[model samples]
Structures are given as C-alpha cells and as structure tokens.
Target: MRPVGCHNEVMTTEIAIIGAGIAGLSAASELAEHRGTGEGILVVEAERDAAIHTSSRSAQQLIPSYGPEPVLELTRWSIARLLEAGNYLAAPLAWPSSFVVAGSPEDVAAMTVPGLRTLEGAELFELCPELRVNPQRFRTAAVDESAVRTDGTALVAWHRERALAAGVEIRTNSRVTGARRAGDLWELTLGAAPPKTVRAATVVNAAGAWADEVGALFGAAPQGLRPLRRTAALVTLAEPMPPEHPMVDDAAEDWYYRPDAAGAMISLGEAEPSEPCDAQPHEGAVAGLIAMIERETSLRITGVVKAWTGLRTERPSDVPVCGWDPVAPGMFWLAGQGGYGFQTSSALARAAAELVLRGEVGDWLSPATRDALAPDGSPDQSATPR
Candidate 1:
C-alpha cells in the first residue's frame, strides 16, 4: 500500500492508519495479521523515526496493576505478549519486572485501586530495599507489585520495525494534512515527498497526543483530547545505579523515579496544562522531583544530566478512548492511552482492531458500556461514565 501521498504508483489497501506511534503501528500490524499478504497496511507517520515523541521519550515500565481496573485489564491482556520470551520483534523485549511504589497516606489510598490490592509498607520495601521512608512526605505507603520494569521504548521500535517488515508501508515525515470521505473510501492528503493521495475504506486515528487534531480532518471535533504535560530528568550518579530499584512514586505525585542503567530517572508526574507543541522539561518540575528524592531517600540532589518532557494524552474519564467514533463511520480512534499506553498497548490495540475489522464485541461489558461504547451510537450516550 502507498502512503497518503506517494507519487510512486503503488497499490491501495483496505485501511489507512495515521500516526506511526505505538497505537498506529499496532493497528497496522493487527490489520495485516488478519488480512495477511493479500493486502498491505499503510502507516503515515509525522515524525522521521518511530517513537520520537511520547512513545520513545517515556521511561519504559510494564506495570499491569499500576492503574485502574480497566487499565489493569488492558495491561493484563497485553502482558502475555510483553512478557513473551520471543515473538515477532526485531529485538528481544522480554525484560525483568519493575515495581511502582505509592507514597503518602492519601496517595497510597489513591493507589489502592479497585480489583487489585496494594502492597503494605513492609511488602513495598521488601520488593525494593532502596526505597526509603520519610516522615514528612508520607504517613503511609503501598506498592503495586505487578509493575514490572521493562523497556517499552525497545518494544515500540520492535513493533514499528516488525510492522514495516510485514509489507506495511511506513511513510515517515509524512504528516497527514487532510482526510475526506470520497464515495465509499477515504481520500487522505499528506505533506510528504511529492504531495499525493491514497484511498481506503477505513482510517484509524492513532496519532498519539495529536489524535483529536488529526481526527478533525474526518469531520471530528476535539472532544476528549486532554494532553497533560509530564516531565522527566536523566541524572547520573557517582556510583553504579541500582538495577533492581523498583520505580517509586512520591506522595501526591510531587516526584517519582525509576532506575536506568545505574542512574535514577525521575519525574514529578505533574499533569500540567500545556499547548500541543514540542515540550521541554520545566525547570521547576525537575527541581521539585530532586527535592522529593532528597527528602525521601539518602540520594543527594545532584544536577540533572538531561531533562525533557512529553504529553500524556487522556480522555476526560482518564481511560483509553478506543473503538470508533459514532458520528464518523469507518473512522476509528485508538488514542488517549495516557501514561498507561505502554502497559496497555497490545490489548487495547487488539480489542479496537477486532471491533473495526470484525464487527463483533464481547457482551461481557456492562449495560452502560454496551450503550456508551457502541460505535454506531452517539459518543454522548448515557449520562454516566461507562
């Protein structure tokens, strides 16, 4: 299949996917698995390389029970593939597990998610000895042991490369300009090598944080596209970093950290409001993270080796917005993975692909979900959250 705009006289396919991030790549891969070599998958990526945005910038971790039950369910569905010793990946992704520790009496309570139990103070520290308690920040603590530390960045690259190898056309630097319905198919315009247009019956908007902005081309409005800014700091220590250090969350999310190659990578986990632009680490955020680490543990506050920021897009309900838009037929949305994207990518992508490619969904969802999640109905269905 040709990209939206490739002057090269190539073939067209059944589907066109926008945004070659994890969601886009996963969708393309999933579609190909169902269709096989008979049809190719076309993926238009705005960036030059895969995972240049939040997909790659994230401090990779695989935490199945690190979020809400729905998020945990998504993570559990994807955990098999994530933990598989070998699969269709360019590089091995099977890595050791990681942990996510919750701080403060309130924050630990907040971490006591539904359908999952939070580890006690002793259990939390037992998993990771480096974690220290502070009288000031936390009156209590809890641990989510299912938080296995893995390289999600590697998994992202692996997914992209595998999708490319599967006869999937990955057009990098090809920012999608417009998407319009032409007859029964979609005529997509792109800003890439020698402007061109590709036609497909279906279009999947997996454009990461820019999902809503991209969906608008197909007559979609910015509804639940809430992109929150999250900052990260790459600081190296004088001694070898503890490889076994479980990822830790500070009280009130003021600061959080994970070990990376003998160095501790930290974040304030701040969901600051920001515009949809190239994000840079906020000085105040980094400073706050350092202060939290210093206050909680024996670690000293050294200068940040490097700092950067990325948007963690989420819906109003803070859940992934998968399936298709009700108003826009043949237009599917797999955005709003938020910080849980890496952990829940596989299952969410599969569930969405199934709904798009095959029109059948399990009746296991509640009555509210059946009404609220049906793509044929209005997204405004049901006054309560599904």
Candidate 2:
C-alpha cells in the first residue's frame, strides 16, 4: 500500500485513473475492493489534493428526478444504495424535502417524476415561508420528499481514505502531459521537471472538465465534452430562513436556493460554456441570482458573503460518458457527468469497476442504461424524460 503523498521514482501499474475527483477515487475504491489488491492500480491528480474542483463545488443534493432519463436511473439507484444507513457512506445521509416550483401547471407537469407530488397554499407556504410573498409568481410546485442532502467533502474524504486503505497509490500533482498507446500498454508522460513516465495496461479518463483533452493524448476521438461554468453565492439574509425550509428550484429551474448555515446558497443555474480551467464566480451571474431571489421570495438579501463557481462537463447527450472507448482499446471514458456527478457517483463507479475488471457490465444496470452510458456516441435508448 502506497500512502497518498508518496510516489515511487519509477512507476508502472495495471490500471491508472486520470483524475482524483470523486469519480476517479470512487471507481478506484470499488476496483480495489473487488480486485482484492490495489498494488496494480494508481490514481493520478494534477492538483495538490483530490476533489478540489467540481467534486467539492456541487450543491450536494441527491434528487433522483433532477436529470435526464439515463442520469435519473443512476441517481435513483445511487439514492437507494446510500439510504441503506451506513452501507455506502460513512456519515448518515440527510433526508431533505426538495421543491420544484414553476410558473405554470404545464411546466410542473413537464417535470413530474415517480416520487413527486403537487403542493400548494398552506402546505407549500409552510415548507417554504419565503415563497408566501410571491405565490402568484409560482403557479404550481412539486415536491420530492426523499431528496437526500449529501456531504461532498465527506464523500471525497471517505473515498480517498478507502482507496488508500485498499493499497491504491494516489499521486497528486502528477499531470499526464503525454500519452502513447504502445501495443497492449499505454506510456504516460507526467508533466514534471524531469518528465517522469509510467506504463499501464489500462487508463481511465475521469478528468472531469479536461476529459476530452486527456483522451486526445491517447489518440482517442473527442467525446464532444463541453465544460459549462455554473456560478453560486452565499447571501446574508435580513432574517434567517428556517432550517426546515426546503431547497427551492424556482423561476422555471433558471435559479435555485437552499438553506445554508449563514443564510442561503443561491445559484444562477445557467450553464455558460467555457474552457477547462479553475472557474471563478461571474459577478453578473451572482447578482442576477440575488435579484431573482428578492423578487421571487420573501427572503431579503443584506449581503453576499461568498461566491464561487465550478465547471460541469457535459457530452452531446447530456448524460455521463462511461464504458470503454470504441477506438482506444485500453482507454475507458468516465467523464461528462455534469451536475449529477455526486448523486450518481456510487452507481457509476460500481458499473465502471465491473466493466474494467470483467470486460463487460453485468445485469445490475438495465440494458438501455448501459447503452446510454457507452462511449461510442450511440443514441440513448432509455425512457423519454418525464
């Protein structure tokens, strides 16, 4: 077992994961668990630590009905797994009421899912007192009571520790600058002072926003992954919202806000296309969200104490890209998760481990789901979005 910060002068492994975010760490942990030895596995991160990007910047809510059909399947499965107290995550999952408010009944109907139900008047106002002032603005609303509030920080730490305990070597600050397929193996050049090289039998591209870039180094065709910047802010309210208040998705999903310890966390919810980099909050986007919160709810914004942003990478299908690359034999695609990364991590990781170790996915996932997640750019055959 190699400690997280330790790295050998000369390195070679059977499998190498190209990102230390939740997707990479979780997949590493699962692969280590089933393989029974992590000595052959290595996790490489460009950053000094793991989960310093989108993994830590997510809103951290697990809503099964909040994504495309393929993503919904994974999210539902992940939620079910996480709910089995103390089974998946070390800390307990928080059950929080999640509300989706719309300006019309048609919009509300458009978002209907398996566990969502209509809410109005007193019941709705009781759950979100701030919405009482602008009830007319929100003509209809639906609630998913099973929504779980996850701890992204805890999730990252847990997966990192688990992978390390299983003897997986995690090398931070080791960026793959060059990748060449050599017969049955891949020769990866790390961007170091001396340009260290490592050879691996398999490579997993889980580089979040930079997945396509990493794939190109190995001659793998681009997956058309678009990195979108999402901005959010923490506002100090004139009066603190009740802790029991449900997280609200208002303005036809253009903006949303959830209760935070300081006051509230509001997001613009706009997916602005951007290049891969450390994203900073757009002042105009944060201002736009704050203004909307004032107009749509009773919560008064006194000051915005904090503002931050993250990049959510999406493929053409808007569903996560998994499975082995059709062109690159030993290369696997595990990126393009977008905003549903945290909610869908566990299910995706399990399926990825199965695919990598067994060369095929079992029946744990539906045939349609497996096809939708394939890396060949095939059309998704999953159920139509509700």
Candidate 3:
C-alpha cells in the first residue's frame, strides 16, 4: 500500500481497525495470522489503552446458554478459544464457576436454555446459599454447572499481545476525526499533534458505542446502533463470601450478581437507551440494585467499595451486527455486541476477518449463522430480550 494525502503526511496500511477493544484486537489478531509478511495491519484507538470502556467494564462470564440463539451459538463457539487463550495470559483467563438462573415458575418455563436443569429444595440451596428469599417466591430455579468466570482484563491483554506478536501496529490516543473514501481506500484524519492520516484498503468499525458515529464520519448510514447504559456496583459484605459461590441471576427481576475479589458485583440489568458517551452509573440504579440484593439474598451490603458503569451498544434487534455493510463498500460492521462481546469475541472476530479478507464466511461458522449476524440482514426483533 502507498500513502495518498496532502501535507506530505499519509500512513498507509492494508487494513485499518478503529477501536482497540476486544473486538478490534481479536480481529487484528486473526487478520495478522493470515496476512503476508509485509501486509500491514493497523489498529487505532481513541483511548490510551485497550478495553477502557465496555470491554473491560463487563461482568465477564462465559455462559454459553445466555443471550439469543445466534449469540448463544457464538458464545458456544467461543468457549474453546477462550479456554485456549489462557496460554497467552500471565494468569488463567477463566475460572470454573457455576451459574443459577432462578425465577418464578412461569418465568422459568418461558426460558429456553440449553443444558439447563431445574434445581429444587436442597439442591438449589446447596448450590447457592446466598438466595435467602422465601423459596416459594421463586418457584423454579435452573442451574448450569459448566459456566466459567471470564477475566476480561486478562483476555484483552492476551489478544493485544497476540496481535503485537503477529506484527499488528496498535496506535492509541489516535482518534479518527474525519474519514473519507479516496479511490479504493479510506483516508482517515487523526486528531493527533500533527493531524496524522491513515490510508487503508479496508476499514473495520469496531468502535463499540461509537460505531454509528464512526460510520457517519465515513459517509455510511446509521445502522440503528443504540447504546444502553448499564450500572454495576461492588459491595463490601459484612461477612466473607465463598469463592465457590455460583453466580445467581434472577431472570424475572432482570438482575444478576456474582462474587468478586473482595465482595460481590451486582447489576441492575437495566438497558436504558442513551446516546454514546462516557457512561456513568446512576446513583438511583445502584441504590435500587443494592436494595434488591438485600431483599433477595442473606448478605447485607454494608458499604459500596466501588461502582462503575459502561455502555452496551445494541441494534434494534439486540443481535450483534457483524460482516460488511450492504451499502458501505470496504467497510465492515463489528459493533452492537452488547454484554456478550467479551464471551463471543473470538468466534465473531474470526468470522468477521474471514468475511473481510476472503469475501465469504468461514467454515467455523454456519452459513445460517453468517446470514443471521450479517449487518444487512432483517432484524430478528423477537430473538433476544433487551
């Protein structure tokens, strides 16, 4: 590739990925794996480091049975890679953690999750003693012992290291201010000291919450990407919590919590729609979650150790939007992953890279799945709950 811009300043590459989150890093890794010795791949990020937003702020868990069918399939496909990725991390990337989804009988009956078994009486209490609510309040409970606690920070670092080892150049604090198509390549103007520019044959918009904004900067139409605010709090309990405690999720109430390093992390499971920004946890939401935790569990949250929030960008259908945009040539859509991004990053990245480099879906993903996750596919509005 050759540089093409004014001011005698143009950096060229074969592929340019916007956003250094897990999605972008993983895609860069896959692309680097298949690239020629001199084929350049560049990953640009607005933040100073990777996964500073939704990617690192997630309540990381590898629950294959979670999300819509398409998401579930991707999660299932990603588990092996997540497990195998532990080799790249200094410490284990994932730890075995049981998962329990408890709700009323009607709520449990409506949930269709694979390998989920009903737990009652002793089995339920034994599995998750934290649930002190009257058993009658939650008539049904489903348990999945195969779940794992994914280390988000470690996973991002692993992929970043892999991409670096594969000769992928990652430039942080290089925000893309303007983008335009120059012949068969994209000319991206960066907000740097000297106003740098990057020219690439293909551009992958893995900008997470800002996906639509990046797309519009490059003359692509919005794909209905909606960023929702999700709040989570780390509460310090009066007593020590068992490290082996399974993650407990009240499906009917739309909240889930699990043991953290010192205390526990609780989420309100609220997906309130908002514009893309530096998301902050609402005090009311955090308080509400704390109250709910107290009402549902025996553990009393004495104090909040820490609290944070992040955006979970979702399309209208709630399914991830991947693959190339039908109308935007040389531009790929790798956004709207929501909470499932970390768990499904490996599989989604591989499939996306295949689509970008080979113009077809990889064998690892089914043709049906390929079509379902394609950016231009008709929205399956009923597939996943917000």
Choose the strongest candidate by lDDT.
2
State the displacement of the C-alpha of residue 204, model 2, in Å, after optimal TM-score superposition: 0.5
Scored against the true structure, residue 275 in model 1 reaches a CA lDDT of 70
Over the stretch 26-132, how does candidate 1's per-residue lDDT look in tens digits?
Answer: 77776677666415578888888767788766878767756655776777667777767446555556565555545666676666554444655566556544454
For candidate 1, the clash count comes to 6
User: How high a TM-score does candidate 1 get?
Assistant: 0.86
C-alpha displacement of 5 in model 3, angstroms? 17
lDDT of 1 at 183: 86
RMSD per candidate (Å) reads 4.7, 5.0, 4.9
Estimate every model's Cα lDDT from 0 to 1.
Answer: 0.69, 0.83, 0.81
Error of 3 at 339 (Å): 1.5
What overall lDDT, based on C-alpha atoms, would model 1 receive against the true structure?
0.69
Candidate 3, residue 237: how far the Cα is off, in Å = 1.5
lDDT (0-100) at residue 47 of candidate 1? Answer: 82
Output the TM-score of candidate 2.
Answer: 0.92
